[model samples]
Target: MEPRLTNPAGLLPDVGQAVNILYKSAHTAGVPGSVLELVHLRASQINGCGPCVDHGARAMRKAGETDDRLFAVAVWRETPYFTEPERAALALAEYATRLADRPDAVPDAIWDEAAKHFSEKELAAIVLWIATTNFFNRLNVTTRQQAPANY
Candidate 1:
């Protein structure tokens, strides 16, 4: 479908400010670029947000991520292609973003596993990464923002 509005430029205020916050959050948490991309892609896959999935997947590849890892991300639990840290991040992503389906909160096992590969700051960043990606997924899906033709 075509866009509901050409830009919706007047709809929101401080759009630049919001983007700045997300950009700072991404860097401050020291979440690796590759890790952040994977988290975004995985969350977007679950949310079925085409823009996020396309953007994240393209970013991952641009950052030199292997096709095997990208392709297997959705089925990561059943594959041996991911490294220990990536696996932990994926698990944490699922647990955090799927909170509606898991009221008990992220389990200790998942945290422990992730903690093994991340510092406290890194873990905090990871959580923020997941949260931020979720926000973008919702925004894109609700707005029906189409993925870019080349994305």
Candidate 2:
């Protein structure tokens, strides 16, 4: 689909810069880059944001994630590719991203599991990553943004 307009980040440089700052901070929030990309891809899949799924998967590959493991991110519970910590982060990402679908938003069980694997700072980063991805997902989906062919 043709996008309604150019990417807002390009159209509005100041707002784009602010988002870039948040994006950069999330990357340094101590979560592994691979785990963060997995979280990003899953959330984009849930949100049906094609651009994000494309970009996130490419980013994961660039970080040396195997295709087998990246492809299995959606079915993480049934896969043996992820470590406990990665699984915990994915669980948290799904729960947080689907907040409107469930009464609890993030159930205590999921939070407890993630807490087991991540320090408070890391947890904050994970949450921020999820939130940031969701923000971009909405923007892209709403604007009918398409993934670049090379992305």
When summed lDDT is taken over every stretch of 10 residues in candidate 2, the lowest stretch is: 7-16
Q: In model 1, which residue pairs have backbone atoms overlapping below 3 Å?
A: none
Worst ten-residue run, lDDT, model 1? 2-11
Instruction: Give me the runs in candidate 1 sitting further than 4 Å from their true place.
Output: 4-10
115-142 per-residue lDDT for model 2 (tens digits) = 9999998899899999999999998999
Put down candidate 1 lDDT per residue, 16-130, tens digits, no spaces: 5786787687667876777777787898999988878888888888888889998999999999888889899999999888987865889999999999998998888888878
Best by lDDT: 2
Give per-candidate clash totals: 0, 0
- For each candidate in turn, the TM-score is 0.88, 0.95
Candidate 2 lands at a TM-score of 0.95
| C-alpha lDDT (0 to 100) for residue 127 of candidate 1 | 85
lDDT of each: 0.82, 0.90
Per-residue lDDT for 114 in model 2? Answer: 97
Q: On a 0 to 100 scale, what is the lDDT of residue 38 in model 2?
A: 84
